[model samples]
Target: MFPSKDAPLKIGAFCSIAGQVRFMCSGQHPTDSATSFPIYSRLLKQPEPVANGGKPAGITVGNDVWIGNGAMILPGVEIGDGAVVGAGAVVTKNVPPYAVVGGSPARLIRYRFSEDVILQLLAIQWWRWDDEKIKREAAALTGPIETFIERHSVAGTATK
Candidate 1:
């Protein structure tokens, strides 16, 4: 459960979170044989190492993203801005900006925007818009997503 503003915070942003989001360091696991063993407890206790080294990495979720319910986002994974992770997805890798990924060991289904457009949207950082403004546009915000994107997407955009 989320805490009240007055309480000491453990979980940040319980409400729909947006903008360059990243999970805590505790979520990743190691894939290499040196660090990996058949033992369950040791594996559970040790955070997985990144491919490059032993240092821990965080899961990063970018702006305007929707991570579906019950998705287990692993450590060191980065979910790019505007991407959507389907419900119950178990993410294991870095997702590109504007991608839509799902399934076990989540894979990229498609990019949500063209390269230029994605870059523009990233710069816009619309998720940082004030809460009131977002509420005012709620209908449009949740409307036919493609249409909404068409109207609000950064300049020089095409459909996904």
Candidate 2:
């Protein structure tokens, strides 16, 4: 994670970040500047960075996300829950929940599950469940999505 006083990298629970996975929160070149050079930062005499109206900032990774080896996540990119970032992917944009993204400036390859299932999981938000609840449903959590949803859905109310 690149250190930025202003921009922070917020990671959620159960993330599997692989080797060389970079969360670049800092090192943003002043693209709005005329020359795209940080004159103030480089030269003591120069004034502060030019007014770059829109600068990308921060990285947010949600729960159950798996970032593969050598993945580079750029500033202001948000990886949602259950998303899979492929190896060596350079993610420049926000990845949606349950998405499987790959390639340079990563594109959405697919979602891990169908829309209905994704919605069900989002609503259930099993990752946020208490320790006892998680332990009680360990088998279902590790098994199939259908089973998990069936057991934990609003109608089922497995928690109760």
Candidates' C-alpha lDDT: 0.60, 0.84
As a whole number from 0 to 100, the lDDT of residue 89 in candidate 2 is 100
Candidate 2 lDDT over residue span 1-160, tens digit each: 7645567899999899999998887556776556666555467543343254335677999999999999999987899999999999999999999999999979999999988888788888888989998899899999988898888776543232
Model 2 accuracy (lDDT, Cα): 0.84
Predicted candidate 1: what Cα RMSD to the true structure?
7.4
Worst 10 residues of 2 by lDDT: 45-54
Give candidate 2's TM-score. 0.86
Per-structure clash totals for the candidates: 7, 0
**By lDDT, who's the top model here?**
2
In candidate 2, the residue pairs with backbone N, CA or C atoms under 3 Å apart (3 or more residues apart, or in different chains) clash, namely none
Regions of model 1 farther than 4 Å from truth: 1-24, 27-55, 139-160
Query: Taking the tens digit of each residue's C-alpha lDDT, what string does model 1 give over 1-160?
Result: 1122221123212135434333434522336556544233254454333443443345556666687776766655666777888776777787787798888978888887667666666655667788897898788766775566566766554434
**Candidate 2 local lDDT, residue 50:** 27
